[model samples]
Target chain A: MAALSWLEWNPTSFNINNPWTWSPGSDKKVCFVTTGATAPFTALIESVLKPSSIEALRNQGYTHLLIQYGTAKDVFSSCAGAAQCNTRKDSRREALTIDGIDFFPEGLKTQFKLVQQSKGLVISHAGSGSILEALRYQVPLLVVPNTGLLDNHQEELAVAMERSNYLVRGDVKDLAPAIQKSEDFKDKMTQFPPITSGGHRETKSFADIMDETMGFLD
Target chain B: MPSPPPLSALYSLSFLLALLTTLLVAASLRLLAILPTTHTSAPLAAARRKHPHATRLLIVLGSGGHTHEMLYLLRALDPAKYTHRTYVVGAGDAFSAQRAVEFEREVEGRERERARARGDGDGDGDIEKRKPKTEMETETQAQRDQPTPPRTLRTGPEAYNIATIPRARHIHQPLLTTPLTALSTLLYSFPPLLSSPPLLPAQPPQTPYEAAAADLPDLILTNGPATGVLVVLAALVLKFFDVRGAQSRGMCKTVYVESFARVRTLSLSGRCLVWVVDRFVVQWEELEGRGGRAEFWGVLV
Candidate 1:
């Protein structure tokens, strides 16, 4: 139930329900961050919007920072001002357009697509739904698990996915290192839903197992 | 007479206790006999002659992550093989139910396109029949170019039904009252497990989907959610009593797939039903042979 609530959360962001309204320019590189919607990870919003993390993105040629802040609007706004100020002080290039959304209510498909098209990076909370969606776009993903969660499944999954080279794992306290690593991770990441999983052993797809269990030989 | 009985060893309280213990042990043995073991179950299923007819597949959709992975695992679902589908969702979970409808529509759309391609007379019927791109690549081009033999098409709204049951335990519910709510959910699961209503009652089953709806599901597929565990329990009760010859007829065969999110350990629901389910599957290699017999078939989703 907590998982499904992401779709029903109220649209409290300044941007309208249509995400395309505040579109980034075609040439701008976007770095998208999605915290959990039902139980908003305020710490993630704070960390990603930290001055050092924003500086890391700017150093990597990023032009936009879009955060799906969930219910942490106050945290987003508080750090967003300082982050923008820091970017403005060094004006060699265009300022990073910083924005926040409480939730999409539908999905983050448009955001993922935008990141894919821009050759940008996606930093998401280590929820399987977001990880699976982000990986489908074949874009570089940095998954940060909330250490505050009672169960450590988020950390366990993030570590395992990283071991398989599917995504990079980030610490909630410091995301700059992981953000910097995303640039090199794109080419080395494994194609997800792997074609040849389980090594030399015969690997059957889910459909094959269904047919086998039913004894449908054909 | 009462005084005499008090002194007799034959009428002692210890003897009565022993009788009760023996009965309890016997009941447990019977229960274990009915539960399927992986080694014996698969071979028995494979030994059976192929039906090649109407088959009903029941799928349990959990909230969020489970539903997402369940749909991906079923991406190559062949409607022509499993003719009818029954999707079980928790009450108030409109998202999962809506996703089920959307999935069916996608199946219907694909089938329509497949039929149209066959009608175009381009000799691409076999190509259209194949679903997975990886599997298609392995077959010779000549084999794929051959015309596919016509089969019954099972797609659209009437071919499937979405059954919703109340949540077994609401979030933050008091632990003391969980059993009562879970029991109610178990009771509600019986109707869908028994048999789905035929598409049209007056007429005999004309389509494979209609025939399947009138019969018990041949398979119950779950991805180890709370609601799914209870549904499997209800099916186990049916098997225990051989209701409607469910056990003898091989209906309600349970398969529990551990979520892909669980790389090393099983989820709570998976831990509960691992031994009970006929086929327990885990995605990660580290989890293989868990619960004595969990299967690993690569990353399914």
Candidate 2:
């Protein structure tokens, strides 16, 4: 019995048998770009990493870069043969360059490792899964809303996290300044509450509610 | 001059009262159907207290935010307390299963660490033998082997597994196809689930449904999704109409928690389940009663 969904394709599951490791001799700090699974984030990607913007980030000390370009083919056509990164399926980190900036289109099979290994900032579209993963590692995040989405809920989540100061929102057009700002925000980001801040489902109270309601009804 | 009430209005009022009376009677009968019958034979309450069994939680995870929020909620819960947990996820929702498995591994890893610290077993040697030999793992493993490790272990894992229910309506499919698909899902979802063994506390379940009913789960938890709707509805049907003693175990309460993404109102899925679930939890206070009944609380994620 297969779960055939009418919606988006679920990426084939991959097992990470080995734990994440810190890459030795990786002196350059990296900035990672991910547009999420559904929407085409090519426009947002172009806005953030314009030739001029990449230069600005380089000037700010982000030496290495990676991109999870889901359906954003046109944006990186210039870097067509860009070496792919390790996907859970193809666990190889093939580094390639676009406009002289390292872009990994194959996507990393080991994402947590990549997130932890990244020494610079993570620029991501405002999807909750992406946001949560970034926040989990206390990584410096700059969330850019995918304005093309049907609902504006992602915008709401970004604003909430922004209010909480967990991550900064970046304007796609003027991202050089945002790249510079990630360093300052990274330090402040530590002050945000740990994501494990909710209480367990209290069973006794629930049982009590049921008992009381039944009693009232009786 | 005072005008007399219209004859048409009076007729309509009488019709409305009759309908209301019928609905109330039907509701009472439904509730009565699920309630436990006569406790006179024995002190079942006292017996229950003296030998209380741990609750088994069946968590239904939707894709994306639903899984995210459910994970946070589970994080706060004590794994040892819930010895048996079944996570029902949408089919082909590999992401949800992946995340669920990842969470369990993290918890299991932490538990192993804590057990080692207490000198419970020769875990140090076992951990060494079990450590991955991959090129990437060696660097981290070596660091972790140091007298002081940078990471702390997380707890909160017991016995839990993921089950799949077909997506009631495939996304991008014709909208009208949903009801028929949902009907098929309803027929098979619960009976098979009901028959499946509890697997923990190591009790033999008779006629899976009876076994499930005997150890009736305290809660049927879900964060709104199309698949979740099928599950909650299936659970309600079982609770309302027991095939193998759902009523005796007390109706397994359904809790529909709205996604954290919805700041001001319930999603369509949440709206649909609100009519039947025991507790409708919203992450934002502003969403309370916006569409139907709901309980206001802060964000879960």
Kindly report, for each predicted structure in the order presented, the TM-score of its chain A compared with the true chain A: 0.89, 0.65
A110-129, model 1: which lDDT tens digit per residue? Answer: 88888888888999999888
- Computed on C-alphas against the true complex, the DockQ of each candidate is 0.58, 0.16
Model 1 clash pairs are none
| lDDT (10s digit) by residue, model 2, range A121-204 | 778898876777667666788998877768578888787778767789877667878777787886667443343334453222
CAPRI quality level assigned to candidate 1 from its DockQ score: medium
Predicted candidate 2 versus true structure: per-residue lDDT over B1-301, tens digit per residue: 9899877875697889998999999988986655333231121231123222344567788876688778866664444334456778877788788888887777676666655643344366554556555763666556567664222232334256677877777777797887888887776578434743454556666343334334556567788878788887788777776745655555466667788777765688987877666667676557766544566544555
Q: Lowest summed lDDT over 10 consecutive residues: which window, candidate 2 chain B?
A: B39-48
Interface RMSD of each: 2.0, 9.1
Please give the distance, in angstroms, between residue A176's alpha carbon in candidate 1 and its true position after superposition: 1.4
- Candidate 2 positional error at B75, Å: 3.1
- For model 2, the chain A TM-score is 0.65
What lDDT does candidate 2 reach at residue B115? 59
Candidate 1 deviant stretches above 4 angstroms: A1-25, A196-198, B1-26, B38-44, B47-51, B120-149, B202-204
Cα lDDT tens digits, model 1, B1-301, are: 3455545786788988998999899878868888876564233354353555788899999887788889988999999888889999999888899899999999988887766544443335555565546654556444557675455568887789999999998879999999999999999999999888767667788865677787788989999779999999999999888898778888888888999889989889999998898888898889998888888878888
